[model samples]
Target: MSIKPAIFLPELLRHLFKRPVTVKYPFEKEPVPKDFRGNVVFDPPKCIGCMICVNDCPAEAIEIIRVSETEKKFKMLLHNDRCIHCAQCVDSCPTKAYHMDSEYEIAAFSRRHLKIEYK
Candidate 1:
């Protein structure tokens, strides 16, 4: 059998002059697409605490607590570890309290860091 490796020579030579296909993610962030579903954001002033978003969320990321008879506390505990990013909560809010933000760089070293609490 021949010991000379000629097949790898062409691939090595072609890659030597080519630009890197990988992106520098930490330094350069790409803009999110218009239709891309991302993290959820809540607006307290616009929210009526109707619990529609809490009811419709498949992931059960939202929790509403009654603070008093006059006021109801809205709590959205977004556990990114469990979230599917389907944008279902945004569509279910009748008061337009929930929105899908474009900030999608949500990598974390621990699962605790991935949990976002909004009150």
Candidate 2:
């Protein structure tokens, strides 16, 4: 066996001269995948003020505050800042009241605004 010279080069060169396939983020947003885990949404009617989500949340981000017109029912309050997106609340919700949405832009200057009542 004898090898005088050896050279290996990629055949495609047009891609180098072409515009970038990547997007400029913050200014531009790429489409989220069909199964991406982003933000959470709560369905007030579906939830029976069950404590399953509150109990199961590893982050302890969920709280159920019952409106005491009667001891029977109340609204659920969720703190978005305390949530770590573990999806525990979603998984524990028996009525499918909780779900993850594709909208991940949940940033805010005040943490209080992040808290939302299930309604």
Candidate 3:
């Protein structure tokens, strides 16, 4: 097979001179669209301690701990690392305790930081 550098050179040079296609991340922030599921936000006041969200969650990221049986108080532990962000918790919660947050830049150096606790 014969090789021709001249045929590819023009196409490469044309794209090289043109402006880059990628958006400058960090320098320019992109907004999260409406109803975009980023992170799970737990509302303690709205929680009913049903554990529906915990059961429905495919990743088993949500844990509902009953703080007080008489008081009906509950604590929610959300593992961001384990969470698939499927929004199943939000949908499954009978009391609407789980909601999705707009903040998508949830990068962390340690897994401990990713764990969110709601009381």
* lDDT (CA) per prediction: 0.79, 0.79, 0.89
Backbone clashes counted, model 3? 0
Model 1 has an lDDT value of 0.79
Top of the candidates by lDDT: 3
- Between candidates 1 and 3, the one scoring higher on lDDT is 3
Ranking by lDDT: 3, 1, 2
Tens digit per residue, CA lDDT, model 1, 26-115:
799977789888888877767777888788889877776554586665556677777888889888888888888888788899999988
The collision pairs in model 3 are: none
Q: Please list the residue runs of candidate 1 whose C-alpha ends up more than 4 Å from where it truly belongs after superposition.
A: 1-22
Candidate 2 C-alpha lDDT tens digits along 1-119: 66434332232454667788888998998899987777778877676776888889988888777666655455777788988988888888998988988888899999988898764
- After TM-score superposition, what is the CA distance of residue 109 in candidate 3 from its true location, in Å? 1.4
Using lDDT as the yardstick, the better of models 2 and 3 is 3
Please identify model 3 stretches exceeding 4 Å from their true place.
Answer: 1-22
lDDT of 2 at 47: 69
Which 10 successive residues of model 2 have the least lDDT summed?
3-12
